[model samples]
Target: MHGPPDARSLNRRAAIKVGVALAGGIPRLGALSTDAPLQEPARLKARPGDPTLKAFAGRQQINTDGAQALAWVPESVKRDVASPLVLFLHGALRRPEIYLEQHISMADETGTIVLAPFSTIGTWDAIRGAFGRDIGVIDASLRWVFERWRIDPRRIVISGFSDGGSYGLSVGVANGDFFTRIVAWSPGFMIPVKTIGKPPVLISHGTEDQILPIDRTSRQIVPALRAAGYTVDYREFKGPHAIQKPILEEMIRELAGRR
Candidate 1:
């Protein structure tokens, strides 16, 4: 069986290499070297195909190892059609179900599917220090969804709010080819491992955000991303550390093909 390696085999090899590197070089202590940053451990392995679960509308709980994960499928969606999907991360000390409930309306309005996965602990592993257990949780949740639904690859997005927003930006940068779009709401900072495909970014920050000040966060991030040749759509509003309803709706409209 001497032939070109399949996508799954290549991805598996990459994962193994990442595992060895993390085990030998990158310590769980979360030390990032200036010359070499830690690569993101999680990778999207599943693709659109025949489903295992019956496609339906509304929320579905897909918890993993006691961690809460949820998906919101739009009403009247069909299994034969590929639907847009969003991988949403939650803020620090937040729950995925609450976050999904707050933003699931956007998915319903635009016929997009929303998947929100909880961090193993208080916050995302990367934000705490280095990428760890949460990576496996996210990847597992995604594989489950991919095995149960037809997702639109072109419309797959990574988005979040506050701490989740920061983590989403970081992960989206590392896996931009898979996540076609990146949306951050009142993000604080980014801990990017490596830049992958160039995906357009949409960031909305509150000018008066006290939790994660706008000046030190998105203000600095947007410029760096632009300098690195990323097309960023940055917006500033007069509010606190929260998602602006109108602004978010507009962004979702653009993503949902309504605009």
Candidate 2:
């Protein structure tokens, strides 16, 4: 809520107000006050639960749409090393907090900033998908994070499992300028939307997935993406509809630029 660590109190309040307004769906900056410069939140290196990611620790920040998120910031960044940002979306009926906890160490291990946003509803737009309000809250939250963190824009990633995975493909492709990579685990389908810069994509689906047949899912989607000239890495695992820990670890390492 507070402006960047050194900003004045007035700036902090003004920034919070501005953020609230933007989160409320006013996409136009002119609507808030074209003349005012919204100060960013101060860099809080660590919070209560995490001695690593201060304000970005375990707490949930609710957006105007009532959507919420949990984030993790790496403990340190090597000299000349630009930290990456990873936003992981959970499957349907899943909590972002769980994803945060599950991947907390991934941040330190990779010197990455991790964010997991929860859908305000039972699931992201239920059956009515296509990067709706959930995407808005995500974009706003990411903007807020950007104000405080010096994340590498070229390494920004949008990844998820199941339905979240499907949405990641749709949104990441649409917002290629912001997200350089998309990792979809057990994705169902992609919402054929206008795509931008050919961001690299990683699609992993279980061969035994009964919920969504692989032949009709990643098998087809990966080829289509490649046909569209997008770099793709497709992996087929023998299992049911689920994300394997080993695959998760591999993906994180890949994103971190580690072999």
Q: For residues 1-259, could you state the per-residue lDDT of candidate 2 as single tens digits?
A: 1111111222345434423432423222112121223231111121111122223433345453354677777657532345677888776665667666666676778777788887767556622433456766676567555555566656778898776787677767766656778899877666545555677888988887655567666776777678667899888888766777777777777778832
Please report, as a residue range, the 10-residue window in candidate 1 with the lowest summed lDDT.
1-10
Runs off by more than 4 Å, candidate 2: 1-66, 77-81, 126-130
lDDT of each: 0.71, 0.62
What is residue 147's positional error in candidate 2, in angstroms?
2.3
C-alpha-based local distance difference test score of model 1? 0.71
Worst 10 residues of 2 by lDDT: 40-49
Clash tally, candidates in order: 0, 8
lDDT of 2 at 8: 21
